[model samples]
Target: MWELACLRFRHLGVSVTPSRCYRRQASSHIYIWDFLTMKRLLGLLALSSLLAGCASGLIDPNGYDETGTASYYGAKHHGKKTASGEPFNQNALTAAHRRLPFGTQVKVTNLDNNRSVVVRITDRGPHTRGRLIDLSRKAAEQLRMLRSGTARVRVQALNN
Candidate 1:
């Protein structure tokens, strides 16, 4: 006949097992270990994703020039927090870009009217699809695009 014994650990229901108790006790230990390991792996994955987002938010602005449709945002988004963590002010000479780093200054030229405005990159996007850059009300006004709401424009990143 075989003898069997189980020893408890700190009252956690965990036990050291002799042969007869091996299946039950060992399986519970494996489950606990697997759960903890899975949680740790998920935590690491989340942390890496956050770090990657921060790293990829910035891109080289050198020689960045493109022609695309531009639009403006105002009143509705005023006083809201931007991606850069600043309050959006429609009256400021600022703009939102998809790739340019925050604080980058870009020259926006309205191809139709030959009007231009220099704006600091402050926010994130135009939100609407197929748009190039989103300008503040003041920037739009400077570029003479308020009435039209959108413009065919050339954006050139300044070396600052």
Candidate 2:
């Protein structure tokens, strides 16, 4: 029984001390307990892998891939907490993304007039559904979208 127990653990890649196994009865209940424990351990490992895969910056946001209008918020909302937990900076050339990590640089091009500006993502969201991004007031000025408050644009994710 002891030899068989050692062989089973070796096959499963688990190292169990001989002293501990020798004290336990070679019963059906013990086998069930061992199977349940291995299943639980494997489940935890799989869950951890899934969480790691969900971490940010895994997806690229750059190139001529995304096109839309961009708008900015400022003055009344300046210094307010953004979705990424950072304070909004109206003067900074920063923008917001729905999923991109904070500090990602994106090139935003105004498709209507062919003007483009690179802005860093320091926050999250344009909030409104269907909107691609939210830029700071300064970024809006750079893109010349302040007059109309929004412009048709293309946003590409830049390499770090």
Q: What is the TM-score of each candidate against the true structure?
A: 0.74, 0.60
Instruction: Name the top TM-score candidate.
Output: 1
Model 2 TM-score (2 dp): 0.60
Alpha carbon lDDT of each predicted model: 0.87, 0.79
Candidate 1 versus the native: TM-score?
A: 0.74
Give stretches of model 1 more than 4 Å off: 1-33
lDDT of 2 at 80: 92
Worst 10 residues of 2 by lDDT: 56-65
lDDT of 1 by residue, 1-160 (tens): 1122244332446544465455566655555568668999999999999889878877899999999999999999999999899999999999999889999999999999999999999998978999999999999999988899999999999999
